[model samples]
Target: MNPVLSSSEVGVKINEWYKMIRQFSVPDAEILKAEVEQEIQRMEEDEYLLIYFSLMKFRHQLMLDYLEPVTTRIRPTIDELLEKIETSNKGISGLLSYYSLFFRGMYEFDKKQYMKAIYYYREAEKQLIHVPDEIERAEFHFKLAEAYYGMKQSHVSMHHVKQALDIYNQYELYKVRKVQCMFVISGNYIDFKRYEKSQPHLEKALELSRELNNKRLISSALYNLGTNFADSGDYEQAEVFMKQAVEITEKEKLTNLPHSLFSYAKILFKQGKMNEAIQVSKKGLSAALYQGDELFAKLQGYLKALYVDAVDQHGVNQTIEYLEKNKNYSYVEDIACETAAAYANSKEFETSYVYHQKMVETQTQIQRGECLYDF
Candidate 1:
């Protein structure tokens, strides 16, 4: 077959590639990428089309990393590409500019830099007027919701989720995206302590995930269900759901395996299963270390310190420092509150008061910071 084609023909193929990425169809995307590149080779002129192709290529890499996380230490090729794009551009189209900012947000989101992700997403929203596709707008809202959720800004997350879900519900081809939006809604409900409300969304998501035959979505639904149960004081049911979630992710070698393991270990700890929790934590920590996931490693280490090993103010303070340094004020507040309760249970009123004060301070900090982005 001839590899060379008119620019319009190559553009159609690139469009198909973007659709594959949206659907998370890695195999099809990989094949389409090769075909698109072949068509692009030895072609000159049409710089606008080439810029669009380059942006799509960047998005392809983001999709790949999202589906299966990069295990080894890799260079920041996306960063380099974005820098090149910005530097060489004399006048790029509004659509290309929007994609550049949006994909940059995705890259930051993947790195767990939620604040930076939200900043870029907000910037991209300014250019959203140029994007006429409602589905693409839904995608943007969904991604913004995810960034908000990562920062524990459930209210802001819900605002975006509602917008995305409303648009996604109108399209039959967006069932996968609909499932993801439901997951975010359920997550926000969980954060709000509306476990009953959370369950139905997750159940619907699970049903949709099974109907779609998407293992990743299925595992996520199961995990969220587990969290709902655990938060509602149903440890046994939580364990059952979480165990299934962990098993499914592990069997599939999914990108969320480390997270599942860490959450499962936390559930075990809650059940007063010290030995089992410690063992699970060790397994998760090893996987996190192997994946170079510093966040999980620190989280699991804190779990071990608080439960597996003897609990002390020093260990708690160290973890609090780490979270504070990372700007994870949500976690800082949570850990501080838990530590305050623990000290209270032990009849250490002074120590409890100290942690209680710390928790209050952290909460104030979080609320003040999030106020800037309030919708």
Candidate 2:
């Protein structure tokens, strides 16, 4: 414990460190870890400082966990932070409530619980009125946009992203965040199949990301541009951009490696490079399986399509079995449709008819929004 410093003084020091973490300016990771441990120890003697320290640590850890490929290691810290926030008094609680809610939203977002994230984010929004910091508000909106995007609510995602952009544009220091907002807007346009609208945003994001010398941002911009072109039937342009994105993802060991590879393989398939597409899709499936459940599902869809086109009924059967075992209803219709077509080609009318019926039923449930699976 620091005998010379009062609780308020300790809070001030914690706040300074918190700002540094938020601004992505922490100088040395090892040193910062040591300092954080020391501060946490001191918190044993000061309740006020404990609240501030816990909030700041939670913020820092949340950001780190978001960047990590797996989050199991950080779960204990997150739970402890939530407990600390819940037990605090009104005065200290008032100061930390928005951050607590925001972190909870991020935690859920990272876990791929998009609807739960949206709920926590909405709760945070109610506390925003008391928090007068424009930059913080912009950050909150950006996070909300991400949650909406994860839920495939593209219009709502665009709305929140635009709000974040409006605020970020007012501050020169927030140029990076503004560029990220542009990327999100571009993605939303792509989701809506508004390729023409997505082009300028991707171009701007690419230019800004290059200028900032940010490999991840540059790769993401290129990937989005590739997806936009592919969706618009521009196979040549899609192949060029997607290959660049895949190269960057591979060299940088980025989490988007599987996604980029899948996109590139899709372009190859569109360009009639059957052998290359199948090979690349197989590699992407391996990578996606290691990455996470979401990426794995996406790769399964790609591989299923590739198998259907290649006339590899065995491959299709294997993928369908996996999907069925996992109860992945979102892709059930597509898988059934493909299986039906494959059987029809083989002149197996009875089996084809069975799968065709399954396809129709799944499609109807999807149209009625009664399916449990979501991408």
Highest-lDDT candidate: 1
lDDT of each: 0.84, 0.71
Where is model 2 more than 4 Å wrong at Cα? 26-36, 47-52, 65-95, 292-294, 305-375
lDDT string, candidate 1, 177-200, tens digits:
899998899888887888999999
TM-scores, in order shown?
0.92, 0.75
Off by over 4 Å in 1: 1-4, 69-76, 90-93
Q: What's every prediction's RMSD, in angstroms?
A: 2.4, 5.3
- lDDT: worst 10-residue window of model 2: 66-75
